[model samples]
Target: MPVQRRIFGRPIPAMSPRRMAVLLGTIAIFAVLTLVFTLPSSIPAGPSLGKFTDHKISLPKLKHIPSPSILNPFRQAAHAPPVQKNSTNGESSWYSNWNWLSPFSSSVTLDENRSLLPPLPDRPPIYTYYDHTIEKEQELKDAENAVLLTWRKAWWAQGFKPIILSPAEAMNNPLYTELQMKQLEAPMMTEMSKWLAWENMGTGMLCHYLTLPMGSNEDPLLTFLRHGEYPMLTRFDNLGSGLFAGSKADITAAVKKALANPELKAAKDFISAVPPETFEIDPKHDALAYYNDETVADKYPKIAGDIVGNGAKGLLVLNQLMISHLHGTWQNIFNRGIAVVKPHPDHMSYAVHPARRLAEFLAQCPESPMPSSCPPNRPKCKPCVASTPLKISTPPAYRNTSDLYTIGTVPHPYTMAVLTAFRDDISIPWIRRESPRDPWVTALTKELLGTGVSGAPRVIKFKEAVASQYGTAHSLWITAEGDMPDDLDWHFGFAIPRNATDNGRSETPVPGPERRPPVEHDFKDGPVPTEAELEKEKALLKRAKEFGEARTADEEKIRGAIEAWNLADTEAWKFARAFLARSSVERKKWEEEEKKYAGGAGAERGKSEGWGRWFDD
Candidate 1:
């Protein structure tokens, strides 16, 4: 309150002259600094609103950008300079007056000092190897060597690599077709039997006769007889068509040629002494014809005689029907006839036979050649035997009595019967159908070998063959029964000796009379049968036995009746053989008589004059 000054109608104190001068100087200095710093920043050429404004202000207007030309920089016209029409040369020029204006353009100068390149040569063929003809000759020679080796192996009964048929070949194969036809019901049953045979043979059993197509080149019969050892012949002639045309010399020559191969030198013994009796079927008759004819025995010697003559020690005629069809060949060979045994209808079809038991025994005693002596201390495996051996003129069963003192005793050569527990009829369409559960030999073998026996027929056969002493017998006699069905399950059985002495017998003690062993049945996957069930099974077996006996009796009667017919056949055959033996002599005599009659001209004149001319008159 010293002095009050009015600023805007209010009283206030006034400042001194010095203070006023200071305030004025401060305001002037601030104004000068703002003008110097802000003038340049406020110019419209470049302006920025960074950190200065407080009041609203108008923004500066922006100028419009110029429209650019649409011409493409990469255009053909842009890449090269225009041609100078007034110049002497017609070539284009690269130099331009304004080329430096473009930042993307190169600074290097372009020149027209280029020349054309030479043309390329023509292309050669893609493939050109012309030595196949020479290579084929080498391949053929290699094949010959392989064949020679295989032939020697087969001769040794070492088995052979089976001929694998192509899909096309299999479909047309006659043997395969027959197999299909025969096993249509149990389509895989035959295969199962074959596997069993193969297994048995491999383990300890004797060599088996495998059914093969007649014309197959790979057949063991043919392999030994004709083509396998003959490298020069690419293909063998079919049997019976003209098998006898070639002489023994030709066979010897083939053997010699085969031995010439260095690879086969070690096999000379096999080639040189290949048993002449290796071929069982006579080459004079067609195989199909001989198999079908029942009178073959009557026309020739008995089938057993033929077998023995061909060096067979023992013959197992399993298909009794087939043998019976040949009149009395079964009785003549084995001294007994087999009757068919029908299986229970409700029972699942399976294979059970003495042969299977023999196979099992063989599998168990793989190292032992004689199944009876296996394990040494085990009960001597007793086998079924015929009451007496047949007295044949051909040859007696070979005997090897030296081993009797060493290995206890050996039984006389005998043929045991192996009966199947299945229905023989498969001709009916309904019976032929099968399911996946039905056992297939190949599939069963793979499954059993891989995972052990799962109750498959193959496994069962192996087990049975191992458990039984049936192999102790010389051969097996398999029987079939009932209405001889055409589609029978693998009805034939044969066992071939691996060595020349297969029929040889030791001086072993003779087997006692036939006696039934106590049955020791064990269940692998099911409970044992009740007393009633056991009784029922026994009754069923009794009925089956009675039926079998009745059938056997009937068969015996039929055989007796047929025996008379066989005698007639024998007489006829005897007459025919006797006539044939003197055919040449008779023909010579007839020719001589004709010549003598022609020479007698007086008799011819008398005959012409007497009745012939008079009767006509």
Candidate 2:
């Protein structure tokens, strides 16, 4: 059997238990040693043990770095370090052998020092400031009221009855209220102050506010004062046919109704003649007739001396008329002898000047006679004259003369000239330069104080003085209406026929401030304007004057043309004249159209016509 097994070659025999055990143990030991040698150690490379661990090598110091001992795993000084007393200096510190940890915590670190805020006072500073402002406003109000009171007393004493409107009633019309009127007065007040100061120094002038009433007799202010009523509100008619609320009839009716009130009657009883001392001369006796009787020189006085007195010797006739109207009771106030009702443009009696009509005709005349220029019998022979018959009438009992002519609706160009001169020479300059704290104002204030006048009276003395010098102090109409205290409605259009609309009627003009709108100013709190700003303002005013002058010049041209055209008797001229003779609305439209057509023909014609060129260069 052994010999046969030998043939299988190398067949393994079963080992003994002891030998197998020993071999298994030895193999286990060898596997364990190999695994132990191949596995990596858990320790990481320390910061100092890396490439930077070379002798004398240094690492850059990083900014804003945190403590290293606290972050280092090798160091365990994160908590409290061992405390040790300094043997040499008797000082105590937490770090003894450990050099990294700080003795104190981060909470106690004092790196940067800064100032601390002081404790606030019991009362805030803002409250004090507010109180001061309120007090100041009250003081100003008191001062203003005092001056107004003094003025009222002085005027009342001088036999000037207050044309006071009910504040509550005036409240209905925004323009008439006290507060609103004050806004309008603000600029005037500044001028008034300057004027007053100048007056205190003996520079006599007149204020615009003092010279005019709150409104003209035709304005609603009269109705409001006389009747405590407003007229029926009508729609704004482009045709201009609608009756104005403040008509004579309305005023008369209001006056009649108002007479029933005993309070008004009692107030009327107080009316008396002004004192002699109130004026330099007997104003009523020396009054010059402005409309017809006298020229400006005849009505006004020449200077008493070579130096020329600062003021006129006597009151103007128109001013006297205005005053008389104010002084008279409602019963006799609107008497025809004194106050004639300004006629409405829609009335048949409303007439244009014949000269104006003639000028218009001549302006339309062709250089060479057209078919219409000459009649059939006299073809191309002579220029035709457009005939306009004058309406002749006998003078009424009120008139001294019987041959009175109807005045044209055209306002004289002199008014425009005067307005321009005033604006450029006086108003604009005053507005830009006037200030309440001006030297003049200070001087006046001192003078007032010297006279034992203080508070509002002292302040108001300035207003009074200004009124005498620059304002219409002669105008005694006192309105509670604040917005339009000047008694002017500046928004009204020109009353000329050329400005008429296309509705075959003229616009109802309001008798407000006759001059151009004034520049806005704040003499109270506004900063003084620079030279550049003043110059700009002056330029604007100049432009305004230019515009006004241009309009006036255009009106003059139109009037001249109308006169010339009226003289031409040609059929075309007659027909054109007939069209113009129609309502002002129609005529204005025709004139505008004529100018437009004429402007296209030649530059000379274009340059000659002025009516339709308000915006044109």
What TM-score does structure 2 among the candidates reach? 0.14
- Give the whole-model CA lDDT for all candidates, comma-separated: 0.25, 0.25
Q: Give candidate 1 misplaced runs (Cα > 4 Å).
A: 1-356, 366-517, 522-535, 548-617
Report how far residue 68 has shifted in candidate 2, in Å: 99
Clash count in backbone of candidate 1: 16
lDDT of 2 by residue, 409-474 (tens): 211122222222333332332323441212222232452355343233332333232122111221
For each of the candidates, give the backbone clash count.
16, 48
